[model samples]
Target: MNADGMRGGGRTLAAVDPAPEPPRVGPGAVLRQWFHGEHGVAPIVVGLVLVWVVLAAIAPDFLSAENLVNLTLQSVPVGVIALGVVLVLLVGQIDLSVGSVSGLAAAIVAVGTVTAGWPFALGVLVALACGMAVGLVYGVLSTRLGLPSFVITLAGLLFFAGVQLRVLGPLGSINLPFESWFVRAVQQGFLDPRVAWVLVAVWVLAYLGTQIWARERRRRAELSCVPWSQVVLRTGALALVLSATVGYLSTARGVGYSVVLFVVLVIIADVALRRTRWGRSVRAVGSDRRAALLSGVAVHRTVVSCFVACTTLAALGGILAAGRLGAANQGTGGADTYLTAIAAAVIGGTSLFGGRGSAWSALLGVLVIQSVANGLTLLDLDQATRFMVTGAVLLGAIIVDMLVRRRRQEA
Candidate 1:
């Protein structure tokens, strides 16, 4: 008997032993697990619900369909910007110039199209290309020149702001044609009720399919898969919630195309971050750059790509903002814009310490910020009050993050 634990006979005892039974988990255990992590979405979700409840109590119209639809629309521009912030935060970096980049894009689009008589499409392309170029410069400085991101992006913020002023060329503002496709689409577009329902069904099916595929892969690998009961429960809950939301929103304008676009982007980002090799590298580098480099991650390339993505998204947000507002101005994307985006990303549970966050954070965080702003406006609160309240919320989120990090360390 070799070591006695496993015989070196015709067949070892280990080989003959049945695989251990998968642990049985009840609904209570499942709920606890879902809410267990510091970075989990469950907390923000609960918080959102409480905020909505409070606002609805104070102002009855706050829950009305029209108000909710407007809230969703109001969220898109900053929400898109916040989405990029999540990527940068996940990779343990910062870009203070997003607002400036966005403003420059808006100015370029407005001037190129309206002033230079260029086609709208050409102007948009140029703006995006400019964003890409800015990101490349930042990447080269941080990766090749060994400059800190904070300093590099701070300089970029000032530089781009100046460029934005120059691009506007003293007019300080330009208005798009009111009847143009861009303005109409942003201001008046809404999903058809039937189309919205179909999309919801597709989303649910896709989710169910993904879950099933994951479970099968785990089973094939001889790993413990989540029970089918849990899978079914989750799927049902998601379907019901989404269907209800669609139904409620349909009573007013249904979902806006802008909201749909934002959601699609979030879904894509979430998948890329969670499933792709590049996503894994980003997280690994964020956790520890030296360790990731030793493990053969292309840290420099990853950083460059993330910066490029961040700026590109910021430019897109600016374009959308221009469309929605029917004009571009010097004040189109200002300090408040970037500050709100960062605050939303942090409040939505993205760890400032890096390597821990989700694309969903952008969506939830923006919703929280927008909800607060909207609710305050409804209460006829002054801008000062809004600023103070937002600052308090941001501070609270930071404190929570620090406490969670310390707990992990002590553990």
Candidate 2:
């Protein structure tokens, strides 16, 4: 061949050869990205730590084993309810009536077991069924009737509150029997130290296993994966934190049954939201309902499911709260309860704009709110101040969320 022809042949050979892949990122880079990324949970985690330190400094007894255990106990009701709120928010909907629904469920349980001569188990089931029915109604109203969720749930809030009042009737309040098995389990039950430690270990192992499986799956799909070292480091850190928490709690009363229940629900929710096709649809709807509909998602069904989940969890929370207090009263589910649950979900880093949140947000957010309340109580602050502080903190959290969302959009 001529020189030009030979050069052309060489260029053709070079074009046919595959290019080299880029160098994989190391653990340090991965860590940096995690800390700086829009999706990072680091801010809330760090904020929690800082709040603890401040509270500990202000009230030396704030970190006491007894107080910490009490704080955990106090967080249960709101945390459980907030989990439902998180789900609703993830689907870009709101259920303002959850507190009233909770109140109604508690009333049902109290009236059935205490006044109507029904079995305890039956009462509990009835409460849950009522919750489901309320959810179904709300779902149908919002989805089929084309009513706004806010309006529907707002009406529900008023109607359910009236129902709760009617259910209580002349008595207005009823104390639960302290000897009841359910009451004792919710308020006083705790895991043995050994069992707590074992649970922590199992959780750590499960987390690591899932991470490894995810990495392998991504590799198979030719998608980028986290560095193995990053995965190991992340797992190790999580294990250490979890182990330490369990060890501390074990030294006190061990983990509360309520806490365990809350954690289990959060874990289940997280898995469903992250792994299931239904979860993807929820996210899609939250992100853009029109787009999700165009993509063949069952937007109406998803909305209904979310409402159902929210109300069901709210009912469970009410039951737990009744157990904790050993009573179901006129004040069982009040406006304060409603606001606190919503605030906790938002403060825990769930975006009010929806499409971005996790079940863990409920847990984390409730802890922060409860810690603040506990610390203020320890300081002998009045209820008014507590409300003000909580409101301020909630406002701050919303501001942060909006700023982060704007940044993400800009990016």
Candidate 3:
């Protein structure tokens, strides 16, 4: 097979046969393919739209610019954690201890700065280093000692929770100074209106440039390239959506710096997964570890990198959460937090069976989850109702994933 064909076929072998080549046709056909293609985010986008419509009908203010802005901010911490979950899931591993790690980071930073007299930046760095250490240990256990990830993380989860409690001691909670830059940036920092617009423009332009560059490279290599018209169409649609969102948010506090950071992380992850050799090795390992080994991929190193990345991101997410909330407590990154992160990753369309997903899944999935939680809160629904509804949604996503996998295999 040609290199492109090999790459395409190698994307998902854990649960399904290789997908057949898509028919070469016109732009219209490609557009259709974009929507209905397996593993695309289009379905989740549609689901989010439906969710918004339903919630708006029930509570007219749910879509108000102010609430939407708040929603964006509220989604950031879990969204960041979910992004890490996507990486772990893509590599056919699980990290159930993310919540504990995040909570521990928050505790360390809180105590370090508030009690131990450490500088804020130093505290943050220490916390993140701890997270990386956790991941490194987990990776070694899984790769070297041959322990299953599920068990390793499960044990880590309990152990880290104990560590967090010990760090906090009898205080039970520690609050950061509200005026600290870390807290202010997460809680009160909004992009200037002009800057927001400029960011939108830059993103749109970068997207367009990327598409054109890719097409040119493919053409030069004698590979099939997407037509220019289709490229322009996608760019236009993205520009319109981003422009409209910024305009709406501009009416309120505009985009929060925390939101911007989360998005930048997502964009970086998407690019890495799509364009880097490390990413290719990750997918290859997830698709078939033995085959990837035979093909000369450094399977252990790749898995270790992913685990380290996952915990590091989780730590960062915890830092953001602490900043946003202005405190760290035993309940900071509780069971609900990690569960929500995992559910969001899956709901955003990352396959649990592995090797088929996207970085954007983290954003879309968290949006769905946070939107639901926000809408329910607005309606004064009880926590029980929110849990039931979110659980149902998660179950439905898993079912859909299995059905899609089965269909691909049959095809």
Candidate 4:
């Protein structure tokens, strides 16, 4: 062959040869990537740990079994409401009426069971229905009538507050029987130590099983998967942390049934949001409503569902609170219930801008809020100081969120 032809053939061979594959990412890099991901929950987790440590140092009793048990109980009502708030935020909507809705639900339960001579179970169901009905109205007003959610829910807040007052009458309070099943369940029920340990084991096993299944599925689909080593390490770490938590709590009154309920609800919500079509649709709508509509998502339906979920959860929270306090009164859902619930959702790393959050945010956020309140009380601080501190923490969370969002956009 001629020299020119030989040279050309060599160039073609070099061009056709596959470039060397990029270096495989190490487990450490994978961990870092996961931590810095757009939807990462690492910041909130780290912050929670930091807060706990600081509070423990300041008030040794803060870490006492009794105080921790009280803390978990205190977090229940706001935590439940915050879960629903996470859903609403996911859909880029707000419900300012959650506190009022809770108050109304409590009032309904009180009136139906005490005044109207109805069964407790029946009264509870009616209260839930009332919540759902109010949510439906709010959903219609906001979606069908093209009204802003802020305005609609603000009106709802006032309306429900009035209803709550009227239902309670001039005396404005009704004490629940302390020995009632519902009250006992909320305020006194706790898991046996054996059961708590078994549940923790099951949770760890389930987590590992899911991870393994996901890895296999990804491999079969020819998609990238986390290294098996990384998976094992993560599972081990999770098991250790969960086991420690359960053990510590068991030394006290054991884990509260309310805490278990909150955890289960958060898990269910997390799964639904991460795995279900409806969850994806809600996220898409929140991210860009016009785009979601163009993609054939039922935007109106998603909005309605979110509102309904929010109000329903709110009602459940109120019931739980009533059971804990052994009463439903005009003050049932007053004070900063509204602010605290919303702040907990946001501070737990749920983005106010929407389209990014987790149900776990509610759990973590409420813990932070409750920890602050508990710590301040132990130090003999007044309500005004508590409010200021909580407000500052909330502001810091928002600032962090904004910075993280900006970084994500830049990336």
Leading candidate by TM-score: 3
How many backbone clashes does every candidate have? Answer: 0, 0, 0, 0
178-261 in candidate 1: lDDT tens per residue?
887777888889999999999999999988888898778867876666778877888887899789889999999989988999
Candidate 1: pairs in clash: none
Report how far residue 68 has shifted in candidate 4, in Å: 0.7
Listed per candidate, the RMSD to the true structure in angstroms reads: 6.6, 8.1, 4.6, 8.3
Worst 10 residues of 2 by lDDT: 1-10
Error of 3 at 400 (Å): 3.3
Give all TM-scores, in the order shown.
0.92, 0.92, 0.93, 0.93
Please provide, for model 2 over 1-411, each residue's C-alpha lDDT reduced to its tens digit, 9 standing for 90 to 100.
Answer: 000000111112244557544343555545444534534566667778888999999999999988998999999988999999999999999999989999889999989998997988999999999999989999999899989899999999999999999998988998888888889999889998888888888988988887888778877876666667767777888888888788877778879998999999998998788779998998989889999999999999999999999999999899888889999988887768889999999898877776878788898899989999999999999999899999988887777667766765664
Q: What is the per-residue lDDT of model 3 for residues 294-324, given as tens digits with 9 covering 90 to 100?
A: 9999999989988999999999999999999
**Model 4 lDDT at residue 211:** 81
Q: State the C-alpha lDDT per candidate.
A: 0.84, 0.84, 0.87, 0.84
Candidate 4 residue lDDT tens string, 1-411: 000100111112243557644433676555555555656677777777888898889888899988989999999998998999899998999999899999889889988888897988998999999889888888899899989998999998898999999999998999887887888998899999999989988988988888888778877876666677777777888888788788888888989998899899898888888779998998998889999999999999999999999999999889888988989999988878988999999998887767888788899899999999998898888999999999998998878777876776775
The residue pairs that clash in candidate 3, if any, are none
lDDT of 1 at 68: 92
Clashing pairs in 2: none
